[model samples]
Every structure is written in C-alpha cells, then in structure tokens.
Target: MPRTAATPEQRAHIREQIRRAAVEVYDEKGMEGTSARAIAVKAGVSVGTLYSYYANLPELMRSLWAEPVAEEMVRLRATVEATPDPLRALRALLEGYANFAFDNPDILRGALLFVGRVQDTALAPAPAAVEFDQMLRDAILAGQKTGQIKPGPAAQIAHQLWAGVHGALALPINIESLDFGSPKQIVAEMIVTLMASVKA
Candidate 1:
C-alpha cells in the first residue's frame, strides 16, 4: 500500500472517501469542532493514515471544497461549449453557476470556514472559481462575436452576469421567506434584459 505507487484512480477514490467523511463531520460539527481523529474514525481509517493522505484537517477541508468546485467547473465548461447558440449558452452558464451551489452545499459551506481562518488562500481564487470566471468571460465574448450580445466590455458584462446570479443565489439564503420564484427564471429574464442593453 505504498502511497507513491497508488494508481491515479486509486488515489482519487481514496481522496474522495476522505473528503466525504470530512464533509459529513464538518457539517455536523463546525470546523473548530471537527478534528483529524473524528474524520479518521468517520472515514474508517487510522489518524496516521489520514495524515498520510492529507497533512492536516485544514488541508483536507480545502481539498474537500476545491475538488468538487473544480469538477463542477468542468461540467459548466462542457455545457457551455456544447451549445453553439450564444444565447442558449449564456442561459446554460447561468443555470450551471446556480447548479454549482445547489449541487454542493456541504462543500461550499465547509469552504466558508476558511474565510477568516486562512486569509491568504481564503480570499484567493480557487482553480475552479477561476475556471468558472473564465467560462463566463468566454460566453460573453462568444455572444458579442455573434452579435447576440449588445456591444459592451466583455469583462464588464461577464462581471455583471456573475454578480447577478450570485445575488440570486444569496437572496434565497439570506431571506428564505421571500419567494424569489425559480432562480433560473429570474436569472433568465435578467440575462435577456441585460443582453438587450448590450446588443449591437
């Protein structure tokens, strides 16, 4: 069971198991309440074995959040790339962004733990976050090129799209009582209204 000799698939599977355990423990017990021992027991591995896979709990936490986000980024990119229609791709990207949150609530919540605890990387860009940002920019660029999008700075439009969907996500969390309708529906209309302003 030499770690160095483990196949990529083997390593990925083990890492996934560790991450799932960490996520469950983290959700039930706040980050401070979670420990290497708890994660190890939950994962059915020895504490020493867990450390062999991850240097510490914090590292595991980062991986738990980062890995899923990266995977979702791949999904989002594929979904966008598959659609040739610019407007359709834009819609796909927006829904994909919201779906990222919906699909991985635990990992996202676990990541919030690092906000203040690890200042350097906490606020820093995760690779998946970066990729998602790129997809938004790419989608905007594609729309602009096809004349489906209004003429405006691609980056600005991308940022606006990002912020708008992000707001959609936040409203549901912060004000659960208010019926926002479906996030996608609200965002789809936002997309149309925004695109109208920028259309050539």
Candidate 2:
C-alpha cells in the first residue's frame, strides 16, 4: 500500500530518503533502467508509496533532474544580476554554465538526452529551456543597451550564442574525440570568440 502524505517533518524525511535512493539507482543503471520498484525497495517503501508522491517514473525523474539544474540556474542568475559590467557578467555566465556541466556530468548527459528526445514534440518550451533562453536573451539585450556589445537584434544574437554553446557542449558527449579539452578551456575560448563578435 502507498504511504499517505504526512506531517511536514515526515514529508521532508520521506522526500530526502527517496532522493538519495533515486540518485543511487540512477547512477548505477541510468534513468531509463531505474524502476520504481527498485527505488522503493532502496527507500524501504512500497512501489505504491512511490506512486503516492510521484504520478509516474518520468515525473519522479523530472523532479530529481530539476534539482541540480534549478540550483545552478538560481546561482547563475544571481551572479549575473549582481554583476554591473556587461562583459564581466557574460563571462561569469559562461563560467557558471561550464562549471555546472563539468561538475554534474552524469545529470547533464541525462538531461541532454531527455531534452533531445522531447524538444520538438511539443510547441511550448520546457520550463528549463524557456528560462535558460530567456536569461541569454536578457544578457544579450543588456550588453547591447550598455554599449558593451554592438547593436543587433537581441533575439538573433541570443539564438546564435545559444546554438554555439549547445553545439560545443553536445559534441563532447556525442563524439569521444571532441571531449579531449576541459570544458572550461573550451568555454573560455568560445566566450572570447562570442564576445569579440559583439564588441563595440
């Protein structure tokens, strides 16, 4: 039988336990291979208990996946917001992006695979994708307005930059040879090249 939602403290305990067990299973078997029954057993709960909290496997996986990305996004947004200089802000954003991917390589790979599979199937953007694209657009506009970047359509520039970064990151995961350099080194070079295109 499923465990019912409990008091706040009980809820916290259950959620934390589930998260740890989920990560372990995911790490060992990858997201697709990790099953609710296995996760429940690891968490000392019934599969029904897992369903009580999460509607399905994808829902649970999405929640788990969002945690790290959401945290990184918050940190990146705060860093960008706090920086007064446009060029420095862009650099910080790129640095944060690279660090997030490098530090959480497994999660990053899972997310990329999931995103690639689901992206065009829906017309509406996923929450993370929308927020990420918006952040890039905002940064580009800010740079242009501050005269740190040359005048151009902000949307066009944002798309170009996003495409460049996505392709760079994706290649490393897809092709072994391309994974040779540290992501930081590659991102730094990409940032420099991107910035040069926009310099006033």
lDDT of 1 by residue, 12-93 (tens): 8877788889878877887566888888899888889887887656677777666567777788778887998887887788
Q: Candidate 1 — worst ten consecutive residues by lDDT sum?
A: 112-121
For candidate 2, the 10 contiguous residues with the lowest summed lDDT are 114-123
State the lDDT of candidate 2 residue by residue for 53-134, as single tens digits. Answer: 7666655666777867888888888998899787787767766776777787776676644442232233344477677777
Q: In model 1, which regions exceed 4 Å deviation?
A: 1-25, 30-60, 111-114, 119-123, 176-198
lDDT score for candidate 1 against the true structure: 0.72
Instruction: Quote the positional error of residue 113 for candidate 1 in Å.
Output: 9.4
Task: Give all TM-scores, in the order shown.
Answer: 0.63, 0.67
Tell how far residue 53 is off in model 1, in angstroms: 9.9
